[model samples]
Target: METISIRAPSTPSSATKARRSARTRLPAAIALLPTALVVLVVYIGCMLWTVRLSFTSSTLLPKLDWFGLTQYMRLFANDRFVTSAENIVIFGVLFISGCLIIGFLMAVFIDQNVRGEGLFRTVFLYPYSMSFVVTGVAWQWFLNPGLGLQKLVRDMGFESFTFDWLVNQRMAIYTIVIAGLWHGSGLTMAIMLAGLRGVDKDLWKAAKVDGIPTWRVYTSVVLPLLRPMVVTATVLLATGVVKLYDLVVAMTLGGPGIATEVPAKFVMDHLFERNNIGLGTAAATIMLITVVIVLAPWVYARYVRPQGRHA
Candidate 1:
């Protein structure tokens, strides 16, 4: 005898699952709608508004009239702005490198499972918890020639112990770099320490079995594995470098004759103190562009490239 075979329908189950999933997700979608609207209206809207103002002839107020690239031309021609750009470049290089080097060393030290590990971690990370304003103020006092290190050294019978970089026109920016390193390295150390802890014990044992030097193992094998942490620290430090205002304000006020002036300070001075809104917005726009340029590559590699591969 021949038997007829039949398959149960699948469409109704698939339709039911789709409807159930939609019902489950509807509340979450509704919850996120307001936040999405605020981001669009507040953050993106303000960015567009700022960019628009950069192309105007506004001074002491915002004007909607078109003014071409006149503000940019004036900005580039200004000697103070030129110096500010140079100072920021110098500060950015020294500050980022110094923090990374010092932070890595500190992380290595803490990774040895030293006694009082918690206490050391707390001490190392404590500076990062303080605001930049406080760090700047404290360092300024400590670095002040007459009131801080110079005075103490001089009082101790070394009258020629000149450590007055804080007030010297040529060396003033390095003082800001020093303060930045102190405030930022702690955070980097914490990041690197976490990365170090995640390293496999088997790798260390393998290196030991191979008679490899500890330093060689770290530089050759371990450093590459910590690239993500290094990138994270770099991004955080770079953002700090870009928005560097309150620190300079508290520490130098952009003086020893504008020697320590940064792009952020330049924008503030033009927008508020100097009342050149057009030029200020142009400076701000340049900064925004710079940040976008720096981040685009990382974003593409991190998010976009992975998705492309999956696709």
Candidate 2:
């Protein structure tokens, strides 16, 4: 006896699924297109335009004349620009380091399950919620000699007290650093606290079993685990350092004879106040280059290198 084989009919479920997926994705694609276009047109386009302007002799009005590296050369030679660059370097180093140290300590303290943890966390993180302008203004008043700390101290019979960094040329940049620490440490603390909270309890127990000192455990084991958080906080702080305009404006206005001038303020002065667009754009380009150079290694290590290794 011969037996015939019977085959089941193919269903259109795959085709139906594909059609459903396409229908669902179309709206999302449509929604994203506008944002994509805006980024391309607004951000990338403006960046390119600014860079192009940097290479021109544009002043007062954008002339678009080929000026080559004249603007950069001029920018480097400018005393105010040089001073601004130096001030920024000082501020960045101190601010980043101070924020990390203070933030880590705060996070560690809070991580001990201390009483009033909520209140302490709120107090620490409160400064971060305030705008840089507000922080700057507050710090400016607090550090003022005649009307602030110095006066208050004098009122307490300490007539020789002098806390005049805001108006003191040599120490003005440090005041900015202090204000930055106040404004930024809170954010860094929050980041560090999150990282600390994410650490496995088993590791702590193992460290305890191994008789590792608390400081050693933190310095050796926990710090290594918190590297990502440190990097994140550094990046945020570095961005703030780069765009440090509002704070300086509110506090010092690049005062004490250009002692606290920063690159962002330099750019703004040239672009708007001084009517030197070429110089401004050149400074802006340098800033952009600096940021790119700083971030490239991390970006490659974090994103590109992993893909290459996987491949």
Candidate 3:
């Protein structure tokens, strides 16, 4: 046989391409280093410290003296904490569901290409521009029995009109829900509207050709396709619900005998107002654990599963 020497094709281009890509990304990575460091030091570090302190008997100030689950025991046993947990559940469910429903409807209505679309879009989104503190205060005034809706209605010659939910222990939490919905629905609407706008017009045309009713098309076709948007909205709303402090403070101040108290407020009271750092840290840790428990599965399903499949 004739002597033949055939070398494999060179992959220098691939190597060179990777090198160039790395070189290009170097600047962006460098730029992000400061932010990454800050997040690690401030957020993660503080979280770890808080968790550690939760195991201690710190009061008035942080101390490393271990105390096991004493604080947690007291936390669960406390009526105020129990009420706060319950109130948070109610607020979260109603606030999230209300925002989703109202936001989706608003988005659908806007998608109809009605006249003054800009005006309507702005009107819907304007509330989200205001700070939560402002929204809470404004809604508080509006919900006040003596000065707000009840007063206005009563002044209109209706002696029987009474809308004192803001001060009613049984209904105070629902008032928080109303304010939460108003403050949050606008953002959800904007997000859903963006998703709606991005959808292919061909889908609508096909649905129309099939003689599908609008509501059925939405429920079956359009809404399903907006799952990503829905997920995004849900996450945002859930975060708002979890870290719900400012709104409650500004609106109800956990009034009506702690009817509207929430976990965050509980933590705040323990940490600052009550000078129980141990309890505060324990409450914070509990909230953290609760969030992780609730979100871990969804997060794994949404992100980890896909990446795992690729791996």
* TM-scores vs. true structure, each candidate: 0.90, 0.89, 0.90
> Which stretches of model 1 miss by more than 4 angstroms?
1-20
lDDT tens per residue, model 1, 51-134 = 999999999989999999998899899888899889888988899999999999999999989999999989988988989899
N/CA/C clash count, model 2: 0
Candidate 3: C-alpha RMSD after superposition: 7.3
Per-residue alpha-carbon lDDT of candidate 3 for residues 38-131, written as tens digits (9 for 90 to 100): 8889989999999999999988989999899999999999999999999999999999999999999999999999999999999999999998
lDDT, candidate 1, residue 183?
Answer: 90
Error (Å) of candidate 1 at residue 210 is 1.5
The window of 10 residues in a row where model 1 has the poorest summed lDDT is 1-10
Question: What TM-score does prediction 2 earn?
Answer: 0.89
How far does residue 172 in candidate 2 sit from its true spot (Å)?
Answer: 0.6
Candidate 2: tens digits of C-alpha lDDT, residues 1-311 = 00111111223379887677667666766767787788889998999999999999888998878999999999999999899989988998999999999999999999999999999999999999999899889998999987788899999999888888889999999999999999899999999999999999999999999999999999999999999999999999998999999999999999989999999999998999899999999999999998899889989999789979988
